[model samples]
Target: MDTLCFHDGNITDLIESRTLDVRYDINHNLQMHSSLIRRLSQERELEGHLGCVNAVAWNSKGSLLISGSDDTRINIWSYSSRELLHSIETGHSANIFCTKFVPETSDELVVSGAGDAEVRLFNLSRLKGRGPEENAISPSGVFQCHSKRVKKLAVEVGNPNVVWSASEDGTLRQHDFREGASCPPGGSSRQECRNVLLDLRCGAKKSLADPPKQSLALKSCDISSTRPHLLLVGGSDAFARLYDRRMLPPLSSCRKKLSPPPCVNYFCPMHLSDHGRSSLHLTHVTFSPNGEEVLLSYSGEHVYLMDVNHAGGSAMQYTSADASKVMSFAPIVNGVELQSSASSGFPSGSLKSNVAATLDKCRKLVQIAEKSLKEGTNYFHGIEACNEVLDGHGRLIGPMLMHECLCIRAALLLKRKWKNDAHMAIRDCHRARRIDSSSFRALYLLSEALSQVSSMIFIVIGYLAIYDWQHDAKMTY
Candidate 1:
């Protein structure tokens, strides 16, 4: 199979699958012209699991890549060689939901959360060897903290021992390293008292809520590099909240309002649907290497790139026009600024610089979307309007719109009696549209009900056709 690799914003090479792990030095020309920088082909075929890949992390040196699969296995690969480094098999008994590399560690360790309601830590230092034949190591320590599946994990940049994890159980906890213990402190130790960060669920019964509904669930989280004392979290609720780690009782209650940090200001996909569910499954959140920006990715097939600084005390800047729920994104370290101009039918220059202009455009589209839903006309038009804004400032608000558009379209189609088609369309449309819709997307899903009615109509039409044919045959006889 032929594969393309992107590096530093360039499509430098196209290689065959047999090449597995390969590296290339991308040139300025490639970076200037392409959206992707490097590509590699693999000789060995890798299997894809039922669910999408949730997280991919590179080792400290970027020589290795660790991918966490819903299939419950963490596959390690040589980034340059593309060879299977080692596979660590036992983190959770169920699907391994998320994985992250511990910053500044020579000995590679991965913390994983899964459906088993456990967060397991694996140590790779002793297992380092040349071939796949090397014995895989078991988890060095297991933290059975979360009452539900763990969804997000973050290791403080300079502090490996201080890690934060979020789970479906509606809780976030902080864990630190133990001086002499093999595992970190507050790690499953019988004596240690764990630090509880926040409980946003307000003690709702788990049975009343759905597990897959991450919009209500604490979907994802990340810690700030500049202010290590702050943590950011997002969930089924439409908003992302910021918390102060220094507060004496971390979980007692969040401060009424501590001007939100740079990353907390934007609207997320989870906020766009009325089902009280996020149309997109928010998978991961991270801060840029410079700590000047924040990156968010969602299952809605959209990715958001935003400036953290624009999140003024109360006003949040966001753009939904250009980003799509991206499987993964790595910053381009070297590349020419990709230019845009009004002549090309796109707003000129980088949309990253103009937050207000971008937000204005998105707000207009949102208004159109709301109107379309109320009137039940020009559903596609509403979607297209949203798309136009997404094309302009996708990095800021694309995911939210994409997911909302999907749910809205599905509802519309169902209303038209396009049952099977509506079902299929809902999946495809949601996969394509990535943006925030202020929770309107899920409410517009009346299309699903419409589809059921349409199905019955089709059945009646089919019976009439068969009866007419029989009557004609009898007359001829």
Candidate 2:
């Protein structure tokens, strides 16, 4: 969380260590806890990539690390051994920009997007007996869809067969590999892949320069983990746009839906230059695991974590100012103690059910608060529940759980437009931070509340200064 860039130079891959909690499989009846740890303490670094690592991804179980680099190569590293398992030559003509493992499949398959305007799918199944010397492996399928560099690649959790790629060609193309692989050109033969589902170009006529040089090119795109239908996009236009995937279904549904329009639901400007819009591209726009917040990285020198519920409502910005080191981020996991409780390291009776019960109750309360706000009603019940967790007049809760409660309350208050009860929200955010400074969500909420308060003060001072200047001018007259 503190250091933006873990590796020197540009970070191509920034994935946190995500592991599957086996408790779900152990106890089918109980709901499994999938807590995400956003900031990772550097365990060790494995030097393998010869050039700038373009992208890094962990397999479904977080056992393997697959990384593609500007070196026109892909390296597969073993997570357990902390050693390079195999190095693959992708044979791409340009720098790799994005890479991801195909989830939900038993086969070891990986997909990579590159500057060559192509998405290459490789089969690493043959990596078992192969030694380090026999690491070379060719891609099983190569699809050349984009005319320019493919900047980002995303796959839907519900349907991993469907893949989305954002390109600098000013277009986002959805490709479905379920049909089959694309036939090789000329005398060669391979399975024919499905045609593009949708190719959307952001035709917003906002120019980055005085005289426009090219069309708006998308740099980053991510699908919300919680809300699969929500897609966040950002790019050369310096704006983060959120699109509803439901509206932009496959091409086959066009006739059925009769076309309601598929551009974007809402857009927030990243760079607001007083004179004119600065040409700072939105490098990244990613949703948190819960889909409640969005983390945005700008090309210039800033990172922002905003409550997705308040994207359009508030003028406040929670900017995490940093240099070029701000590129990738690991997802933050909430309720670490809850995760630890499920582990065998802790005794069975000391925790588990008691904490789980409390956490679940708090989660439901948070949901109730969200639901109330969405209905445009008072969230008294939700607020009361949050107070119970925080105040705990007679009840006793651990620091970790208490911190989580504060975060939930602060987020709810923030969504209600913290400016109305700015003091209360700020106090809660501060208290959360004080309880656990390591809580990124708490810190982020605090920054948001503080920014709003600062804006109000600045506005008041500006008015007062103007009044004083007017009086002085009148006296001189």
Candidate 3:
């Protein structure tokens, strides 16, 4: 049943297909992400690169190979024929770092980045009758965003219009070509990037006199194939970083002021043990196709595999200080505050932690809140922790955390069943709704609170009739 081929873009057709009965969608997704790296036995050598090959990528089907090299050339190779299909000059005066075929373009579109800091796009569909004009291998699009060498290019599987780049300039940026697609050809309307995803240099600007120990150069990056929002970044540091892109500040505000680092956790084996003195640096980091495991390649060390949960251990959760700069918690990353790893990825371990440990104050209060909630004995500490965040950060506290606290407090108020407690829960629910209007939990809890108050019994009955009863049981707080 899993062997069935459902139409890619037509979800409705897939749902109506025979594969739907056997959970083909889920199984197929899982099969695509298996982290297992089978030992390499097959070798097929096709040489064309004059200088060393810095980056290579396969098309969506893994049929053809694309190689970018220091020779300032891009080569396309046919696996079966063992022939160099195309050897085009990239027009890059410096070394090339990465190149990829834009997804869903039938392998006709290519994007590449080099040490020259330019992101160029080629529409291979242009190779209809003849090669591009001699020495005029003009790109279809050109983007100059990073001031320093661009190290990596990441394109999401389903989104072909957008491209991501990490640079030695200490910035992670995004380029969306969807808007540029409409512009007329060869005019001044060239596609360029201005979207700053994570600007590590923002914090370093104020401390220019006292330079950072690490160069802050981002070496490699990969978007989680399973969880699209999770971005894995490895740089010139011992620690490999994991970021929930949603926690970063909006582009507008980030440009106006210094935005706190959105690093959810650090993954480092040395940090967890007494090997803090080790000069660890990550060369690359990847999530298994399933996004269930993380693989970290150290500069001069062995590879280590980590379960996503334990890679960044649960002990290093972010505090209100880091929370205030952004709009929400990286809830997915909250599973572990500091996952232990042999070489790469996640939370408050060792060297990376030393750089921004100033946010440590917010951790203890949260731990107390968690302990209190787990004991089921007292809601005081939990509620107090929320209040402290609200009081300390006020409007700056992330709305996601605010919503979480409001719900938690409201749930606890309902459990107490004290006079006017139901009313208070309703108030919290209203507040949570204002922060995030679409929350089903808040809406459901509001109905439950209304059911408790004698005056709103009829209203509660109406809500009960309309709402789904599937989430009816237990106070989640």
lDDT of each: 0.54, 0.61, 0.63
Worst 10 residues of 3 by lDDT: 1-10
For candidate 2, the lDDT comes to 0.61
lDDT of 2 by residue, 70-92 (tens): 99888888899999988888878
TM-score of each: 0.51, 0.53, 0.52
Error at 364, model 2, angstroms: 36
Number of clashing pairs, model 2?
Answer: 7
Segments in model 3 whose C-alpha atoms lie over 4 Å from true places:
1-42, 131-136, 181-193, 202-215, 252-257, 271-279, 311-477
Candidate number with greatest TM-score: 2
Per-residue CA lDDT of model 1 for 332-369, tens digit only, reads 22331122211212333443344444455566665666
Lowest summed lDDT across 10 adjacent residues in model 2 is found at: 9-18
- Model 3, 46-154: lDDT tens digits are 7777899999999878788899999988888877777777877878779999999888888888888899877788887666565423324678877675668888999
Every model's Cα RMSD, please? Answer: 15.9, 16.0, 23.2
Q: Which of the two candidates, 2 or 3, achieves a greater TM-score against the reference?
A: 2
User: What clash count does candidate 1 reach?
Assistant: 52
With candidate 3 superimposed using the best TM-score fit, by how many Å does residue 107's alpha carbon deviate from the native? 1.3
**Residue 255 in model 1: shift from native, Å?**
21
